[model samples]
Target: MSEVKKIATRDSYGNALVELAEKYDDLVVLDADLAAATKTGVLKKAYPDLHIDCGIAECNMMVVAAGMSTCGFVPFASTFAMFAAGRAFEQVRNSIGYPHMNVKIGATHAGISVGEDGASHQCNEDIALMRTIPGMVILNPADDVEAKAAVHAAYKHDGPVYLRFGRLAVPVINDHADYKFEIGKAVTLREGTDVTLIATGLPVSNTLEAAEMLAAEGISAEVINMHTIKPIDKDAILASAKKTKKIITIEEHSVLGGLGGAVSEVVAETNAASVHRIGIEDVFGESGPAVELLKKYGLDAEGIYKKVKSFI
Candidate 1:
């Protein structure tokens, strides 16, 4: 078997996007003035005619992408997660979500990974905002391979898709695995009967680490990589709930309306008794390293392992 190496999601997006552009001539990339940060500059260099930088006008970029969706072209509006989800919510909701447009929102520097940029640049509530919109597919890839699969899946998918990528170079988790990223499908990475840890985005990597630690402690921990947060794999979650007595959720987003909230909604109705949430704890992020933000906000691997182990 090939060794699975960890890679950052944004890097995967950059590599996969250029590949997609080469394969699909209709694949166009538009940035709301954040081509470099969002890694769309590679596509710009490769396909200058197919790439457009909208000069910091996120609203116009959203409208233009929607317009392109109405036509035959496939558009990916690359930008910081905060601006793409916060500044252009209406356009995303009305123009893209409402029409179920085939536009892909390639959001980079998501969550506390914005780090030194402080709270203003961090997308704490981005998942909450996107998950609320109708007909929008939410994908928070865990690693490079998953991010690449998500990019290809978004192009194959018919409706609007939101891809949240981080700036940090995380340890590669999906690099050596033979995996197929499916929309609304949850990946069961490890099996455990004590507790189930369902995580998305950056936290999925932490979840894997936590699961390994838990295993050493004689605690069987089931880990689920729920990349698609919106159409969250309900059946897989419920299956875990039935098998495992406890449930834990981890995400690089707020505790309010993110993966935890989505999983809670499912488990609450399913008569689940033990539920724990690991996230930003309904607080804004601080200006620091991503690892520091995760620890301070109780979203890191050690934090999750401690909390999950308490149940056992």
Candidate 2:
């Protein structure tokens, strides 16, 4: 058998976008002139005419991409999540959400993992910001497999899509390549009946480890890998809630409006349960090592385990 080409989700974005551009001529790519850093330049190199470099103006680029989508063109807009979700939010809401435009937002450099780039470049709130937009599809892939699956799913799914990826090269959890991703469905990696640890992005692995620890201590915790933040899997959530009265949410984003908030909202509306959130605090992270920042923000495995235990 031929060896499979391994890929990081960020790199998958560049590769899959190029392949998509080649296959579909109606597909167009728009970048805010940060192609090299975000790897959107790869697609530009493969299909120059199909790529649009909108200088450094993200808001302007969003409006232009919306315009392109209106003309029956599928636009993959690339930019940092901070700018794409923070600066060009209104454009995304009106041009994309209101009209349900098929625009694939390649949001990169999300969370504190953007390391040495400092706090300004880190966008931990992209999920929260985008998920609030009605009709928006929020994506946070754990590894390259989920990333590729996410890309294919986004292409199949219509309406405004915010695809979030990080700068850090995390361990390829989906390395076995059996990673099955669903848009609105959360996957149960480990099933237990004591408690449910719902996680998104890289934190899913941490929650997995924490669940193992909980098991060793005679607590069988259920772990759900929630790759999709918006259009969340309420079915899986309710199932977990019924099985485990104690629920905890872990995310690489701020405690508000991200995975934690999303889970809490569902638990509050449908099923009643206690939810302990493990994520970056509301405070802005300072310049430091990536691992240290994660520990300080309480997103590490130990932190997750501790928080889950506290709730139960």
Candidate 3:
């Protein structure tokens, strides 16, 4: 077995920004007094002139990023998911999404993975809120490699993008040289015929582990990394549905309107597969260890395995 590397997606985002700053001279970063937590402080350290600390005002930080975008500056705004997707939603909707500004919103510490921060900080509805915005592209990278690629992708793509990152240190899954990441396209991690496990963010690694466990028990479970949420790859979902005939969607988000909801919409339109969504129920998260919260919410590998077995 190859050595597994564990890294927080927020750390990957910070490193990617530092590299991106070298290529794009117009790149600017804005943080809402949470640069250390969000990891945007890396950019601030390297390129202090291009980074702005907008106090603790998330709403104003978003608008400021939007204003900078008008001047041909590609601004990557960093903050917790709670504020970026919840508090500054109006500014994001009106200033960025509505006008189609070229700004990338880096939402870190998203979902139950935020752990001890409790319900107030845990953002289970960010994906849902961002999906409601017109012409907004949502990217949820699974691991370090993909997170770095996503940052570059978001920078190249012209428009409003919400890039979701996590605080937990997840294992590096897509470390091979041939693993390519295309926005809005799903990547099949493991091929199988019995069932399909579609997941995004940190839960993707858990789903892959569940697939391994399922394989040992005479079940061939296909695993897919649906990194992009909005502008989701409907074709991939349908194709996997045709082969597996049964699907299970998992995420670190609410089961209501995250990856599961997006996959359900596609499956309902073109396939007859029975889809089971594994994620946080329609409830607020409580303070606990990140791993403990995942298990309690049935988003862990074991929890996903159990749910998938029953569903299949």
Candidate 4:
């Protein structure tokens, strides 16, 4: 049997820009001197004229992208999630988000998966921060296929968008030809009647594996991949909640204001079902190997399986 393919979504973000640049001449990429790390250097190497290195000033890069948007150019500002969403919060909120510019924020290295970079660089709060901005679209792709598709969707979108990417090379689960990526829509990967496991970003493939473990013990689990967080698929969440009666949200972010919070809100509004959130437990991360951090935080497959089993 062939080994499962793995790729960092950050690489997908860069490759997607190169592909889109071939089609849209007005598409510009702005990087904060960290193009190599964020993978925007792929576009820089391919199309020098289309990529700009704005030094280390993340806030300035955002304003530049906002300005470029007014000139009818779709600008994708690339940087680490810590700087893009945290350091440039003011610029992102006022310059890009408040004015609703046609700018895409390619925030790579999100969450504790950033590994040796430690907690300071690992941004677990980006999703929550971006979610607060009105009219801001958020997409946290699960794999290479979904990440590439999300970049295309962000380019087509007319307003501010936050695209979250991870440093970890995760399994490419959505590689099938029949798979489709639509903004604001959730994809159900497995169907079960016991409980629903809704996951986003890097934790998605792990959640699927956990579901398989649950199946072995007669705990039928439904798995749903929620790529879009801001404009979440309410209908899908409602349907799964009503069917399963128990819901568990998994993400590589904080349990607050992220995917778990979003799912809980939907279930709460309609009282669809009970929700158990699995993510960073509202604490800071420490420096460690990416895989070890995930294990310690209980975000890996075996960890998720144990948590789900206990929850059941």
> Which model scores highest in lDDT?
4
Give lDDT tens digits, candidate 2, residues 143-206.
7778877877887787778998877666566666566777999988898999988999877777
Q: List the residue pairs that clash in candidate 2.
A: none
Using TM-score, give the best candidate's number: 4
lDDT of 3 at 35: 89
TM-scores of all candidate predictions against the true structure: 0.96, 0.93, 0.98, 0.99
Q: What TM-score does candidate 1 reach?
A: 0.96
Candidate lDDT values, in order: 0.87, 0.84, 0.94, 0.96
Deviation in angstroms for 299 in model 4? 0.4
Which residue segments of model 4 deviate by more than 4 Å?
Answer: none
The per-candidate count of clashes, in order, stands at 5, 0, 0, 0
**Candidate 2 to truth, TM:** 0.93
Q: Tell me model 2's lDDT, rounded to 2 decimals.
A: 0.84
Estimate, for each residue in 52-124, the C-alpha lDDT of model 4 and write its tens digit. Answer: 9999999999999999999989999999999999999999999999988999999999999999989899899
Regions of candidate 3 where Cα sits further than 4 Å from its true position = 1-3
- C-alpha-based local distance difference test score of model 4: 0.96
Pairs of residues at least 3 apart in sequence or in different chains that clash in candidate 4 = none
Residue pairs with backbone atoms closer than 3 Å in model 1 (clashes): 5-172, 6-171, 6-172, 6-173, 7-172
lDDT of 1: 0.87
Q: Which residue segments of model 2 deviate by more than 4 Å?
A: 1-8, 176-178
